[model samples]
Structures are given as structure tokens and as C-alpha cells.
Target: MPLSTLNKEQLSAATAPIGNNLIIASAGTGKTSTIVGRIAHLLQTGIEPSKILLLTFTNKAAGEMLERVGRYFPAVVVNKIESGTFHAVSYRWLKQINKNVTLKQPTELKTLFRSIYEKRQFKRLNHDVEAFSSTYLYEQYNLYQNASLDGFDIWFIDKYPDHKPLIDIYMNIIDEYEDTKDRFGFVSFNDLLIKMRQSLLENRREMQEVLVDEYQDTNTLQSALIDSIQSNSLFCVGDYDQSIYAFNGANIQNIATFGKRYNDATVFTLSKNYRSTASILSLANRVIERNERIYPKKLEVTRVSKNYPPKLLIYKELFDQYQAIARNIKNSYTPSNDIAVIFRNNASADGVEASLRELGINCKRKGGNSFFEAKEVKFLLDVLSLIVNPKDMMAFIHIFEYGKGIGTAVAKEMFECFIHFGEGHLFTGMLSPRVFNLPKLNPTKNMQLGLFDDDTQIGSISRFAHLKLSEQIKSNPILKHPKLTDDGLIFFKNFYDFLKSIKNVKQPQTMIIKLINTPLYEGIVEMLSNQRAKLKSGEIDPDKK
Candidate 1:
């Protein structure tokens, strides 16, 4: 909290005259500490607490910075500083003036986009060219809003020239969707910034200084919104190498252009590494240095040395990768619990957990999606569940409705027919075994399957009883049901073939791999590549007051 506690550069930046300032901070270089130091210096220099605005990508970050600031200041002083995420602070400013901001969840907005998309009846387009799928369009629309100030139509056509023929329909659908949102006063997180920027431009706010963290991840719109506050003093801290949100339209240039945008901006570098040894920093610098540098920076390690130089390991298979890591930790002199392996995605954790347990390592995973909650895994589980207990309506619904065109109503109808055919138990009549030596039944007329039903006590074991999934595709009476459309039939046939392939599988890991390859699964995956991410409070229904 004291000025002397900060390093020489940190102290200089914290106490420097603030017209506009950019702090280029690399990973684990005590950026948070410096931000807190800056806040303390502002307070010590008699800047109004009410006029200081702290913005972060997450409220948790803001809370953390303010909590540190609170160590040097009173509750009233810290609370009056107005710290939060861009969306959160913008929503607050808009709500304070009694705007009718109806913030809806991203899923709701996406659903609305989908409904409007379906109304245009784009089952097929040109015979010569491939058309963009609905989900792809939605993704593009979101990208356009976040990435730039240019027209969505222009951006879409420029990026995807093949989609030129389909642009009008897509734009029209978007226009209608926007009109609906306008009519209902529906607002998304992006909308909050746009509205806030517009409002501030018309009537400026009274903030003396704005401080932002992770400024490199901000896209063009966010940068524009930040400038619209009209505060002469700006403090932004970010590292370009740390930028990871490009998929969601993060612009690294925001950090690069900051000094140019504000000609009087003072630029400072926080290059001291307190967390990692020199070896790690050397490897990181080597890797990151290969990329084009927007802002030149070199990290200096506070830790003089490390016992081990970081090794870059490459394996042909994931099993080998996990197996190697697990073995390394298990055989180490240190306790297994003391060693940790971090991965980029939650899906990778599954294999690591399995490999560790194989070596008799007892470990508890902290924050990642478990195998069961996965969509593909859950779908396979539903199939197994329906097979075991035919009357499980939830499992039945999940399995039947998975095929295209089979909604809950049609699935309910399909269930009724299945129950009637199965004689109260699912697959009783359908899964009947095929007697290898006997003559096969006509593939077209499936009602003959009734003669071989397992419930028939009057006859000897029929040749057609106990059908495998592959056999059932052609001979199963369920295939002849009226409610099943052509698309539904195709989905089930593919589903059955996949099921039959994995029906005898003992290893769950193998089955899961096959589950993702199923035509039904592949279609869904192709349509929607990015799995639904866990929504933050900013993305979900924000306060509509």
C-alpha cells in the first residue's frame, strides 16, 4: 500500500501524472499489485474516489483490486470508486437514469436468432454452391457485432464471398431479429456497450479516470465504448501475448493503438517476473518472440534460477501424452498430489484422470466438465438407459427426439407405438434374435415380426427373434411407423448401425469415441462446433431495472 513497496517502474507509473496511461504487463509480473498501487496513489494525490472507475473483464477481478484498495482506504471510499466489468458498469449507469434495459440471457437471444432463421425456409439453396448453416450465420453475426464498426453484410460477404447469393436472406432475417429486439427493448451484453457509448456521447458522464485490466482482450466496440466515456485520463493494463479471446472478437491492436489514440498517453512496462524462474521465462520469451510484436517487451526474472529446464514433450497420441505425464508424476520424488498437470480444455482432463488412476494414483479433479455431463457421453448414456429400462420416459424422449424432426410430441407418439409393438417393454419384439439357419423374413413387410415376438408362448423359438441393431434396421417393425419422417428414419438407421457396432463394447472409453462418430452425433457437431460455454453473470440475465 506504500509507494516504497512498488518496484521502481511500478512506483513511477503509479505516481506519474495521469492524462492517459498504458501499462504493458506480462504474466505473473504483479500487474494486480501495480493497479492497486496506482489506485492508492490516486487517492493519496486527492483524486475523488467517486470519479475513479475500475473496469475488469470479470467482477471477481474488480472486487479483488478494490479489496486491496480497501486495505488503504475506508469502505465508503472504496465503494464510491465504482468498479465492475464493462457490461456491469454500463448497465448500472443506464439503469441509474431509468432506462428500460431488458437484459436477456445469451441463450434466449440465440434462440430468438434461431427462430427467425428457421422462418426463412432455407432447406436448400443453390445446387452449385454450399450454403452456410444456421449456427454458422449466428456465429458470424456475433463476430461482426464484437469485431468492428463495419456493416455485418459487408463483413459477411467480404469474408465469405461464396455466400454472396445468400446474403440478402440472412441480412433480412437479422433486420427482423433486430426489429423484434428494438420493439421489446431486449438488450444483450454487446447492446449494453453500444447503448452506453451512444448515451455518453449525447450526455457525458462525470468520471475523472478510467482504469481497465486485460485491455488487450477488448475488441473494437469495447475500445470505442471506453473512449465514449470522454474521460481524459485512461489507465489500461494488458499483455498482447496473453490475449486469447480472438474467437469472440478480441482485438490485440486495442493495446497497441492505445498510445496512438491518446497522443499524450504515458506508456509503462511491468516486465519483472516474480512467479517463474529464469528458465521458464526464457522458454516463454523464445516461443512468444517468434510472433510479430505489436509492443516490444522483454521479461526479467526475479528468481535467479530453476533446478529444471522446462521440457517440451510431444506424443503421437493423447493416451501416450497422459500416460507419460502420469508416470512422470507417480515416479517423482515429490508426492503425487504436489505435482499438477494443467490442460487447455476440460475434455482433455478425462484421459489424464483415467491414466493417473491406472497407476494407482488417487487424485481429485477441481474445475472441469466430468465425462458424464458431456453431450455425446450423455446421449450414449441415454441410449443405454432406454435399453435397460424401456419405460424410462426421459431416456425414451432423449433417444427418440435426437433424430431430426422428432420433437417431444412426435417422440411421445413414437413411444406409444414402440410400447404397443414391444408389448409394454421396449425392444421385446424388435430385438428378437435372428436364427442363423432359418430362412429370413421379407424386409418390406415388418408385421411378420409379430409372429416371432418373445412373448409368443404358443410357438417354438422363432428364427427372427432377438434382432441385433443392424438387423433391426431392416426388419424392425418400429421402422415402419407412420410418425417417423424420412429424416427421422435415416437418423435412426445410422443410430442403430452405430449402436450395433458398440453394443458389445466393454470399455466405456471406446464407446465414447464411437458415439461422437455416429451420423446423428456428427450432424449435430457439424452444425454446432463450439459447445455451449458456461455463461457468466454478465452473459445471463443481467439486472433489468
Candidate 2:
């Protein structure tokens, strides 16, 4: 904690707060600690915690900042201090201050196309109708629509004014969203900053000092919010070179433009790598050097790890790349250790997963949607619906057997059985019913079957199921009852708590699955495998076996 122990650059960056401050931290450069130290120093110098508005890009980051501050200086901080992701903090602002704030309806691109078709505005294009019916279409529509507005928010829209008709429609929807949210007490993630900025714009006296973390990741709305709340001081720290979220509206140029925008601004750079080995820092520096708009900062490492020159294998083909990576892992990787494979797209990881599985390498994709999108998750959601209302049995089964292509006749018969009997019976009699409608077949009588007992491991269903159940228990206020000790509930609560405790700061799923590894979770894995095998090996005996 001594000034002498600190690197010269860190010391210099921390002390120099003349105007606007920007700290460019290279990978493994102790970025969080430096940020925390800066905040601590300000607090030590008699800057009241309430006056400081610290913003992060994620809830996890906010949580971490709070935790760090609590550890460093607890009593000085207020209980409900303003700090969170830009979206979260903004949302809170809207809720607390904006009485008339409203959220827009989240419509997919397909929905927009359908609206266009219904309104007779769009004839089917020669291109693939399916492609037209995508989330991209909606994004494009939003871009087109929001591009024509007069204000800075609509600068993009105004630049492309030819899309005025679409812009008018989209703007109306955005306005309606605000109105509807105000009418029915609903606020969106983005509306937080919008409403707060509006509040300050309408009533400027309420503005206060602001401090934003990861300034490189600030979007237009967030920067605008900071601009609106520009009073005491604007302190932001980030490295534009580490800006990886350009796809998600993050504007790295904002960091570059901070001085020009804010006439009274100071820029500082932190260039000491404290987290990684010297070799790793060298590689990271080399990789990011290619990126333009990079601040002039050199990351020099003091600690040198024994491991040097982190492997960078490049293969000829995509499959070869995957196989080579997997093979390398097979040779050197250990189980239960963190090994990240970063990708620009989800599609790129699919082949890696496939190739890794082929090599019998037990690897999991770290960050992308895992547990939520699994087949088992769909199955559990279906089951939950069926349990809540037995009439939704067909719907449940359709979701459960989604990829298998269940026929209408088979679906109807299943529905009929569910109406007559119950989910427990239908589950027990899965093999007995002629779901495929061949000759009368009753496979359930032959296979040992019984009601889904409370003791059976439910987590063993699927990653999706496990994730859904975990999320449900975590989010649902009603289900947190102390008396609920049923076997399924016990399994769910235990896994949920475990997953919650091992919360991911960056790669969320990495921590989630790491938390989910237990006997109960293993059972869920087995159940999913058995279900797949049942269909593949003619063991279920329902359709044709």
C-alpha cells in the first residue's frame, strides 16, 4: 500500500487528477486494484462517498467494486451508495426519479417483418424469407428507424434521413415504450440512463460528480448521462485497446474524445502488469498492439512466472485448428482448472466443441449460453408448465421432444392421456403409448417405471434444466421458503446456492458449471445421457421399438 512499493506509472496516474482522467491498463495490469486505490485515495482526501458516482459495465464488476471498497474502507461508504453497471444504475435512477419513464416492447426482427407484412408495406423479398425473419432484421430496422431523429441521440438517424418513415415508426415505438412504462411502472435496462439524463436536462440542479470504470465500454447513452451529471468532476479509467464490446454499442473513441469534449480534462496512463507473467504480458501487449486507437502505454511486468511463451497454435483448416487445440489440451491440460478459449462468435466455438468431443476431451465452452439453452432446460420448463396446469401437457411434451419432430396425431394422443390421467402417469407410461401410432405397444409395462420420486436427482436432467431450476429458485421470491425440504427442491436449492456462491466475474457459465459439479449434478448428467441413449438404442420402446 506504500507509495514507494507502487510502480512509478501507477503512482503518477493516481496522484494526477487535474482535469479528465483516463487510465489505460494492459491485460493483467491490476486494473481493478488501481481503480479501487484511486477511489480510496479520493475518499481519504475527504471526498464524501455519496458525492462520488462510480459506474461499471456489469453487475458483477459493480459487486466487485463494492466488495473491494467495503474491505478497504467500510464505514466511510454509505449503505445504498450509487454504484452499478451503467444500465443498472441508470435503471435505478429512472425508478427513483423519473415518474413518467417507460420501457419499449422488446420485439424480435421477425415480429417487425410480420408487422410490415400485416400492414402491406413489405412484399416478400427474393432473398431467403427465413433470413429476413431474424433478430438482425430487427436490429437493422432499429438502426434505420433511430437514424432520423434531430437530437444527438438521433445523430445516426439524421445522418441517414432517407429512412425517415422507419425512423418515425421506431421513434414512436420508443416514445410509446417510455409512455407505457410510466403508465404501468415498468423500466428497461437502457431507460435508466435515459430517464436520469432527462431528469438532469429538465432540472439541472440535481447534477453531481461522476466516476465511471471501464470508460472504453461506455455507450452513447451512458456518456450522455455522464455529460448531464457533469458538475463536481468526471473521473473515468479504461484502456481503449481492451475494448472488446464494439458489437454491443460500446464506443472506445469516447475515451479518446474525453479531453476534446470536456475542456477541463486530464489524461493519465497506468502501464504496470501485476497479474500475469512477464512473457504473458509480452504476448498480450503484442496481440493488442495491432489495434489502432491504442493509448501510448507500455506494460512492464516485474513478476516472471516459470511458464513462458503461451502457445498460439494456428492450423490450416477450422477443424484442424479445433483438433490441434484439443490435442494440445489433451497433452497439457488438467481437469478442474480454468482454461479459457475466447472467440469473436459463438459459431466458431461449435466446431471446437465438436472436435474436442471427438477427441474425447472433456471440455466445456466457458462464456456462451450453456445451461439456459440446453434441451433439458426446455424439458424442465415444459414439466413445470405441465405441473402448474395439466392442460399444457401437449405443450410440455412438444418442448421436451422438440428436436425429434413429434407428429400431430402422436401429440394429440399424448394430450388425451394427460387429460385422462396425470403427468406422473404419462411419464410412467412413456413407453406404453403409441405416440408414433403404429400397432398397440406398451413399453412402460416392461421397463421398470414409477412416479418421479422426490429423492431422484433432478439436476441430472440437462444443463438447461439445471440452469433453469437454479435461476428459478434464485430469482423467485416466493420459493425461498425454509420449510420446503422435498428431495427435488433440496437438490435444486443446494445446486442453486452453490452456483450463486461461485458467481462469475467475467465468464459467467465458467463459474456456473464449476459450481454445479457434484453428485447430484452428475446424476442430472446421467439422466440426460440415458434419455438420449433411450431414443438412440430403442430403449424407450414408445415410438417404434
Candidate 3:
């Protein structure tokens, strides 16, 4: 932790003259340590900790830096040194300026975009709107906003002519998205940086020194925010060769052109590799040197090489590849934690996972569907949200079509009707005679109630049959008889009852637990179990056979 303990390169970079310095921190060359040491030096040099800002790409990284800084420095200095992700710091500043400011979660924004996409008519495309309106679209929007593009349509058309058809639709979506956010007084993650930049410009509160980690990963907006707040004493650490997030709007040029941007900038390179062996470092350097534009730096491995030659295997087919990987994993006696099988995408993970499972090995997939984004999880969360806030029309619409037969069109119409009548809740609206005109029950279908084999369907029907639907049926015939299938009616009634049961329960965890114990959870579990069974049996090949 001492200044003398650092290698010559690290020590030099960490204690360099602080005006507009750029530290080229190659991967695993003590980047975090350098940042920590730099901050320590700043505090030691009679600089006010309050005036120094350390910005990281993730909260985890910031936490690690803070933890290390606290260990090496006094609490007085560590506490005063503001450190956090760019978004977190921005949000804090924005909140300080306006206490009432609120941010919309990514999921909520996506839902809003999806709802808008569904409501509007546009030229049909091969892609599903739900699939098309994802994080990628949001990233594109952020890029355009950051670059200050006047017209995204022209920019996108010029850049990607094949996607020109989607340009107009995306523009419309963006318009609706902006209007909705304005109405709700909501700001997005990207908006945090933009708003923070505006606030800093108006307030003109400059930091004594600003330190940025992973500077290569920064987009234009983040760079702008940094420029707005920094007092020209900037220390940025990044490796241009390691800038692999271009798809996410990261500009490698930020690192490549840093010296040019700040003419007086002192550039330092930390090329001592402490993580990988000499052989691995050689391969990495060879591969990265192929890049047309890069800051040249030779990495020298400090660690002793194992002298084991890397193996490359060729397979005739996808299954053969999976089998070979599985065999090697088994033969090597590698613990699952120490072993990593990476692929091009999530689709490739399925086959590897299947192969591992077939070999009686359990492997956890990292970075697949987020817990909140999973279909079953989302459905339950929606149901719980609807129970707590019945006016959440999106939640109501989502849950309305949980069971088969109640398609999107039907659900949309029902929601429109509820809104037209100015109803209090969906259940209350369904029971209204003015809203739904129910018909007589079909005797044949009623008699065939228990004939269904599916437990899920039978359970739903049983719940619906027990509900007092006479009042609803009298008002709307569509709500009566077999038109609303036993399965559909049952799910609706049970869900309504579940909502009512948790109506007074304020604890979200309690509600979630209760919801998870319901038949819906069981159904999801059973479905997944069946899918796994099929996968192992080779009915659904992991290799996409």
C-alpha cells in the first residue's frame, strides 16, 4: 500500500503532475491500485478531499476503490472524496439540485415504449416490436442525444441503410417516449448525465481534480459531463486496445485522442502484466496489434509462464464441439468456478449448459435473462403491483392475458372499456353491467368441467366456478358461459382473490412469497422441469440440432 511498494511505472503514473494526465492502464496492470494511489497522493499534497472526484463505470468498482482507499487513508479524507458510478454521481448531484426529481427504471421505460408501439400503427416489419424495442434501441437513442444529432432518421439512414425502414418508426417511438417521460416527470439513466451537465453549467461548481476510471468505455454524454464539472485538472485511466464496448456507444477515441484533446496532458502507460502468463500476454498483444488505430504499448508479463501450450480443437459439427469441450472439462478435473466456457451470445450458452448437464455437471450461466425480466417473474410482479395499485393499467393489461384465449386484442379492448367507464379497478369494472354484457352459461361445457387433464387449466376453472359471476354475467354475456374458457375465468377469479387477500398487506416480500406459493408458480416450475427433461432427452438439442 506504500508509495515505494508500487512498480516504477505505476508509481510514476500515480504521482504524476496532476494537470490533464492520461494513464494508459492495460488490463490487470494494477489499474485500481493506481487510481487509489493517485487519490492518496492528491490528499497527501494538501488538496481538499471534497474537491476531488473519482468516477467509475460501475458501483462495484467504486465500492472496491472506496474500500481500498479507506484502508490506506483516514476516514476524513476517504469520506470527503466523492466516488461512485457516473450515473450515481449524476443522480446525487441532480437530487441535491432538485429533491423531487425521479428516475424511471429501465423496465418501466421499456414497457412504456412497448405500449406505445402496440397502440400506434406503422409499417410492418419482420421483427416483433417487443423484440425490436430493447436496450439496443435505448442505447441508440442515448448515442444520438449525446452526439447532439439534429435528425436521427438521416443519421441512421446514412449509417445503416438496411435499417432505414425502421428509422421513421423509431423516430415516432422516440417522440412518444419523450412526451410520456415529460408528462410523468420522469428522467432516464441517460438523462441523469444530461441533467447533471445542465445543472453544473448553471451552478458552475468545479472540482479541484477529476479522476475517471475506464475512460475508454465512456460515451460522448459522459465525457461532456466530465468536462462540465472538471476544473481542467483531469486524470483519466484507460486502454484503447481494451475498448470493446463500441456496440454500447463507447468511443474508443476518447482514450485514443485524450492527449490531443488536452494538449498539455502527460500520458503514462502501465504495461506490466500481473494477471496472465507470458504466453497468454504474447497472444493478447499479437491479436490487439492488428487494430488499425491504437495507442502502442508492449505488455511484459511479470508472472512466470506455466509452459503449457494452449490447445485448439476442430470439430466436424456443433455436437462434436460440445462433446469435445465437455470431455476436456471432465478430464481436466477443473472446478466449475475456475472454469469458464464463453460463447458469442446467449443462444450459444444453451448448448453448453445442456452438454454440461448431460455430463452430470451443474453450471450456472452468467448474464442471461435478469430475474425481473423473466416471463414468470414479470407476470407475478405485475399481479402484485396491480393489487397494490389498481390504477396501473399496464399491470392490469399484462395480467389479463395470462391464460390462453384472452389474446392481446381482447385485453386491449377490455382495458379501453375500463378507462372509458372511468372505473376504479379492473375487477370492479369487470363486474359492472354497463361494461360487460354476459351471456348464459353453456351446460355442455359446464358439465365437462373436470374432464380437462391439465392441472393448470383445471385449477383455474375450479377457481372461476367458485367465484360469484352471476352479476358480471348478467351485465356482459362475454363474461358468462364457455366464451370465457374455464381456464381463463378461473385464472382471473383466483388472481382477483389473491389481489384482495394482499390488498392490506404493505410488505412487498410477504406479498411476493404468498404469490409464489400460488398455482401460477407451480405451473411455471412444472413447465421448466418438462423443458429440462426434453432437453436432456435430446428432443430439444442444446446444439440446436
Candidate 4:
């Protein structure tokens, strides 16, 4: 059936303005289509695009919404419509409102200090590389970032003993960073929301309407930004079950308490599950029934099929679980099988990847480059790309090129090490250089090593390299002495052994199984366990299915 056949009452509850509006959209229920259509409907009804601000949680989502609306209403002007991730929109507003507000670039937070760690910066942070672990120092700076973005009270730092000193030091550096950014007219993602909230408060009368998408992901500051605008009408769309951004500080309470907070607020529930088979929907519903206080919605599937009842498996050990799943898929799995292994965390994908790869199955990670694009890994690769071919100027200068306060003596040492060792040299051997001459480095070479795939799969390569290092260490009697109590070395060695055994496996499920046995796999398991605990502890309810 065409979307137009769907009744308005079947749409986002935001269409009805009872003062404040809350929409609970279910999974695979055309949430984006409904949102875009709503925007088009609002426009057709004569709401000025400029007056109706549509806020989303991610830029990609905003872009998609804009494109969708354009398809339906070609003549509508969208340039003035406020549509973007909360940070992107906020940044644009903040740039206009606080012209003098300078921002610290992420590079400032990634600077190197060699007081203790003589190893690579990324490894130092993950393992014990520095005399004083930089994780504490890095997290100290991160607190300021988080506070600036989310407005956590300044006193919150006192709760952590290790962070207190960094907080004290931050009081001085933050001022300097802000001053420098202001002088240069720069802004960071955090600076955007901080400024937007300030702008909305100062110009409250000018604000007319605010429409928020994925309202469940709103943090304290984001919610405040909308509230401070004092808009006459507030419209929000999201389901509590889909609030998956707790790690980024999203407040579930924002969605959970809409009715109580807004006296005239009207709560609307979209009870239809328009995208799943009856069996599939039933399984999902049953699985989520364990969570409490979810809006009561039952799905009735329109289509009937003889497929086996939706399969849900519980395993005592994660390894055994992967083995069982892998065996089933290997016999006759196709790429278009539409198997989605949704995990609570990105790291959880590792084990699944290994298991699938072991079975020679073709599997692509579902998400974007977030896993491989972490600050630590990127910095390490930046250095490697430089040494591999200085002519690869893009990679050569990216290490210390962006961000503030990263060009310190320690940064220079890292750069020099990269220059001294040619591209093919071992990371451990190259980093052991006695002297790093930063000034003598020259980039006049015009050689090119061609292009390389720096995708998420490269992480598997890095893991393999670490595993090889562990084996080489074990072979040396002196280095294998009992004094070495670090389990990291042993785990990586075993991980490499496992990887070698399934080197030809090509399926995601098989690769996942092998990857899970790695030390990193355990870390991911711990994270999942923690999330489960939080769900059980009243912090989150998994039942909003």
C-alpha cells in the first residue's frame, strides 16, 4: 500500500500540537519516511521553513531527511530550514551568535607527553606506556570536552581521584585554548552546542517552533538548547526502545518524561510493525518483553510464510555460541541472506567477523569507519603512512597537522622516528631509535607507493602483527622469562595462532568466532555484560521493543 493510504493518526504524534508532542516510532516502521513526510506536510500547510526548526542527532540523518523532502516538494526552500545533527546545527548558530568563542580542536586532546612512556602514543594509552598513564590525562581533558558539550557540572570532576589533578590543570589550559580559538575564529563540535544554547536563550522571542528527531538521544545540553528557545510549539519523535546512545550521554529521561514535563503534552504510540514477518515480530516482541514499562504495542504481520519460528539462541559461552551460529551459515549461506548480528557495542563485531571469515564467507561490517577511525589508531597510521612514502604528503603531515597543541617536542620525536625508519621496518624496532632528528627531515621526494586499503579489515592485520610480536618474544629464552606477567602478550600470541589457523576463512560469522577468543574479544564481552547490568539496574529497560 502507498504511504499516503496510511492515516495521519498512524503517523508521528508530533503532527498534533497539544502544546508539546511526543512520538514513539517502532523499529523498521518507516520512521525516516514518516518524519520526512511530516516535514513536507507541515510545509504544504504554510509553515515557514525558517520558523520550523527540524533537529536531528546525526548529519547523515539530516541530509537523508532533506533529500527525502526535496523529492516530495521540489519547490520548497530548505536552505533556511534548520536541519542537521544537534552539534552541526548548534555549531552554525553558535558561530553566528558567539563570534568570539574560539574552540579547541581534537588534536589538542591527542598531544604527546613523554615524561614516562617511551613507546608509541596509542599503545601507551592502551597498555602502560607512559610513566603516568595518559589515559588518565587524556580522560581529564575529555572531561572538559564532555562537560562543555553536555554541561556536566564543573564539580563533577572531584568525584574521581585520578581526574582531580587534570581538572585543576584544565582550568588553566581551557582558558588558553578558548582564547586561541577565539583569536583564530575556530570552533569544535562541542563549542557548537554550547554556543547554540546561549544563542537560543538570548533570542528566545525569535524562536517559533522546534522539531526534534530521535529525541531519545538528546543529552541534557541538547534538550536545554531546545527548551531555552522557548518555542511556542515543540514536536519530538522517537521510541524509548531505540535509545541506543547512552555511551554518548543521551538521557532516556528526556523521552520518558515528556508528558509529565509538558503539561499539554500528548503522547502518541505507533503500534504497527510494518516491516517484519509475524514470526519475526513475535520473536522480537517476546525477547523484549523482559524489559518493563514499554508502551504496549502488538505487531500483526500481514504476510504469511512457512519459515521456521524466529530463532533465538542462548549460549553458556560466547565461543560456543559463535561456533553454533557459524556451522549453520556455512552449509549454504548467500550474501543476500539479510543476517544482521546487532550487538550492543562495535567491539562485539570482532568475534562475529572472525567466525565468518573462518568459514570463507563474505561479510561486511554494518557500520561506518568509527571502529578504525579512533584517535589512537589514526595517529599511529598517520606516522606509518609518512614513513612508507614521504611523498604521500596527505598522510605525512596529518599526524600533527590538525588540532591544537600537538606539535610539542614529544610530537616531533614521534615524527622523527617515522622518518628514520623506512616504511617496511618493524614498529617495535623503529620506535627503539636512540635519537630522533626532527629538523633534518625532508619531504622533497616525489615517490609514490600507490594506494592502500586502510579499511576496518586493516585492524585484523594489526592484530596479526601484534600476535607475531608475541611469538617472536616467546622464542627468545631471555625475553620469555617468568618475570613477564603481562597477559596482553600471551593473549595476542594465542590470538595470532587462532588467526593463522583460520587464515582462509571468509565469512563474518566464522571470523567472529576466532576474533572473540582474542583479548579484545573479552573486553567487548565485558562491555556487553555491563550494558546488560545497567539494563537490569533500572538505568535502562530493554523492553521498549
Task: Give the alpha-carbon lDDT of every model.
Answer: 0.74, 0.54, 0.71, 0.56
Residue 525, model 4: lDDT of: 47
lDDT ranking from best candidate downward: 1, 3, 4, 2
Best by TM-score: 3
Candidate 4, which segments miss by more than 4 Å at Cα? 1-3, 11-14, 76-80, 95-108, 112-134, 137-154, 161-167, 205-207, 287-307, 314-323, 333-337, 340-358, 365-545
Give the winner by lDDT: 1
Note each model's CA RMSD in angstroms: 15.7, 15.9, 9.3, 16.3
- 1-545: candidate 3 lDDT, tens digit per residue: 64656899999988988699999888989998898888888888988999999899898998888888788788877888888999999999889888866686776666556655553333223433333444577666666766542577776666667766566667766776687566546788888988889888888877889999999899877888888884858989998887878877787777778878887889899989899887778888888888775566889889875765566788879887887788778788667789999898766778888888899887888786677887778887787776666556557657765565654434544554554443434556654434343221111121112112122121122435565664434244334333356666656556645655675788889888888887766655555555665765557544432
lDDT (10s digit) by residue, model 4, range 114-151:
21122222321232222234455445445445334533
Which run of 10 residues does model 4 get worst, by summed lDDT? 449-458
Residue-level error in angstroms, candidate 1, position 13: 0.7
lDDT of 3: 0.71
lDDT of 2 by residue, 56-137 (tens): 8777987786677777566547444578877676666666664454443343123323322222112322222222223444
Candidate 1: global Cα-lDDT?
Answer: 0.74
TM-score per candidate, chains pooled: 0.67, 0.60, 0.74, 0.58
lDDT of 4 at 23: 74
* Residue pairs in candidate 3 whose N, alpha carbon or C atoms collide under 3 angstroms: 436-475, 436-476, 437-475, 437-476, 437-477, 438-475, 438-476, 438-477, 439-477, 460-490
